[model samples]
Target: MWQIFSRFLALGLISFGGPAAHIGYFRKAFVDDLQWLDSKQYASFVALSQFMPGPGSSQVGFAIGYHKGGVLGGLAAFLGFTLPSFLLLFLFAVTSAQWLEISAVQGIIHGLKLLAVVVVADATLSMFTQFCQRKTAKMLMATTAVAIILMPSMLMQIAVLVMAAIIGGILLTRGENITPENPPITLNYSWLALFILCLASSLYFIGQDDTIGQIFAQFFQVGSLVFGGGHVVLPLLEASVGDYITPDRFLTGYALAQAIPGPMFTLATFLGADLWLESPILGAIVATIAIFLPGFLLMLVGLKSWHTISQRPHIAGVLAGVNAAVVGLLFAALYQPVFTSAVIMPLDMALVIIGFSLLKVFKPGIVWLVMGFAATGALLTLI
Candidate 1:
């Protein structure tokens, strides 16, 4: 448990670039270095996260921990990975926003964004090599990437995954055994039941006169319904808390969430602090937990059953399609928010190339990569 916590805690401190980048970081750390799971299993976690609502990368991390050490491990991973962002956002809520104007701070953000580009680009190529081996799979991957790049919306993302699954079911299955050879893990339905119960309770309390209840209800509803991870949650969060939060403050919190390392969903921590006037810290805690709860519960429900269900021939085919589409999804993400956001100047592009080469050829530790890029970014400001 301590091992799980410590490793994820390390990631929490430096896993920037948002959900897509987090996926890349997790792949390199767990799949490539630690060997906690293979590429296929990691891809499966990523695919499963796509189908569910929550922070996509965090869900993948949770699944990895759960894979390694069960429910306790999953909880540890969640806390470890989310702690930095949670605390940072909470602090942002309490402090003045003027520090954002500092040149050094801006430079660090720029460099980390570039590092995200390098890491995500590496992950995309590696996953593409692993998943899109055949012509059909490759075609699926290409078209999915093109479609997402052209029309990038939550609805579009979901539609593409569904289409990929249907196509995979039709064409991907070959001379492969789909039978469950190993003993299957037990499927725990209690988590699903708890999820439903919480959903009901939140809805019920939302109508009451209690501030805390209202906070939980609103955030919980958002968590339960939101798809496409943290980025997609932004608009919904704006709607959920618009009554109490002003547009400018909301955007400010969002900007900070983007610049910082960790899950973007920690925007909840910032907004939650404002919701309760008497004790902002308590509000932050409640809001953070509420917003993240439903996703974790649903994840627990799915993880218990995924191993057995994925063994079925049809399900396996669907998974194959989803896996292929995930590569394209990451590819699309790499270009837009990850690459476009970071690579503004020609020097940035040059730095990205160098970073990618380092990742591919030298394979240095991510901590070193982060430090190097951050320092370089800060230095670039002086030039």
Candidate 2:
């Protein structure tokens, strides 16, 4: 527990660049350095997290901790990674807005954002090779990527994934067997059933007039429904609470969150603090937990049955499609927000190529990469 907490805490503190960047940082630390999980194991967790709704990067972190320390470890990882952003977002809520406008802070953030660009690119390359090995799988990966770039919406993502599954079922059904890594989760069906029940109950009553209940339901619904990942939270949040939250506040929280670490879903912390004036702290706490609850529960439930379901040939084929689509989805993300957003200038492009080349040659730990890029970015501010 201590190990999980401490490691993730360091990650949370230095972490920036959002979900795609988080995955790169996490893979370097947990899989490459710690040997807590192998690439295949980590990929399984990533696949599942992306497959389901909720915060993509956070859920992946939770699964790693779950793999290491069971339930307690999962919670430990969540707290450790989220604490940095949670506290920072909360502070952003209470403090004057001008604090974030400082030049040094902006320089650091820009550097970290560039670091995210490198990290995400690295992760994308790794996942592409691992997940899209077959010809059909490769084709599906390309198709999915193009489709997403063309239409990057939550509903479109869901449709693409569903179509991928169907294609995999038809084209790639007979393939090699994937050996099981760890045994099934011991949490069992009773807990999973209860989780589903609560999720369903929350959705059923989301229209309630009560303030807290409404808040919980709104977040829970978003957690349950979102398909793409943390970045997709913007539109859903707007639609869910457009009338309640002012455009300025919503945009403010989103903008400030970009400069911080951990999952973008921590936007809930800011939204909660901003929306519920009487109890800002309570709102932050409740909204954070509520938004993340459904996804966590789904991981517990889904991972338990993954072994049994995956063994069948037909199911495995569908998973192949799903995995391919996951890659495509990530590939699309790497371009839009990850690549296009961060790589603006000629220097930015040069930095990314240099970072990638360094990673390929030395294979240094992510800490070195993060620090190096951050320093480089900060220094570039002078020029």
Candidate 3:
């Protein structure tokens, strides 16, 4: 349990760039280094995460922990991985925003964003080699990437994955007879019931005068409804909160969440704190839990079954197609938000090349890489 927590905790502190980058970091740490699971198993988890509605990358981490040590391990992974970002956003909520404006801080954020580009690019390439070996699969990946890059939306993402699955089910399964191996299969329906109950409860309590209840209800609904990634929750949250949080404050939290490590859902932590002035910390805690609860509950419902069903021949082909599309999703994300935002100058590109080379060749510790990039970013500001 401690091992699970410690591993994910180490990741939470440095897993920046958003969901795509978090997936990359998880691949390197769990799949590449610790051998917690093989590449296919990790990819299976990633593929499953897309179909579910919560924080995508965090769900993958939780699934990995659950695979390793069951329910307690999953909780440990969530707490460990989310703790750093939770604390940071909570502090950001109560503190002055002036610190965010510091030149050194700006430089560090720039550096980390650049690091994200390098990390994501590497993951995209690695997954491409593993999942897109066949010509059809490669074309699926390329088309998915191009389509997403051309017209990126949650709807488009879902459609692409679904289409890929149908195509793979028909095309990729010929002469492929390997049986899928899954961990002990245990279907738990109680979790689905609990998720439904929570959603119902949120609707009921949302009309009440209790501020904390309202906070919980709003975020819980947002968690339940938003699909694809954490960024999707932003607008839902903004609309749900009504006038309780000003647009400026909400955008500030969004920006900070983007600039910080960990899940962007921690934006809920910030908003919860801002919502309830009486006991801001309590608000933060409740909001964070509320926003994250639905996805985990739904995951618990499906985790075992998804693994079991995925091992079948036809379903395996479906997953094959979905996995290929997922690589493309990562590829598209790397260019738009990850690459475009970070690589603003030739110097940034040069640094990315250096960092990518080091990652591939020397393979330094992630902690050291984070520190070095952060330091370089700050120094660049001074220069």
- Name the weakest run of 10 consecutive residues (lDDT summed) in model 2: 178-187
Give lDDT tens digits, candidate 3, residues 1-383.
Answer: 99999999998998876787899999999999999899988987886777677889999999999989999999999999999999998998888466768999878767877776776678688778888999989999999889888986656766887899899898887565555354565778898889888888888888886667888898898787555555556545755774677654665566557667898888899999988889989999999999998888888987866756556667667767876887787778777666776788999999999999998999776566678788999999999
TM-score of 1: 0.67
In angstroms, the error of model 1 at 131 is 2.0
Alpha-carbon TM-score of each model against the true structure = 0.67, 0.68, 0.67
Which candidate do you rate higher for TM-score, 1 or 2?
2
The parts of candidate 2 lying over 4 Å away from their true place are 1-77, 80-85, 92-96, 175-222, 225-280, 302-305
**Model 1: CA > 4 A from native:** 1-77, 92-96, 180-187, 193-295, 302-305
The lDDT ranking, best first, is 3, 1, 2
- The deviation in Å at residue 134 for candidate 1 is 2.4
Taken over the whole model, the C-alpha lDDT of each candidate is: 0.80, 0.77, 0.80
* Model 3 per-residue lDDT at 21: 80
Task: State in Å the error of residue 4, model 3.
Answer: 8.5
lDDT of 1 at 276: 83
lDDT of 1 by residue, 191-245 (tens): 9899989999997988775479889998898787555575556645765686678
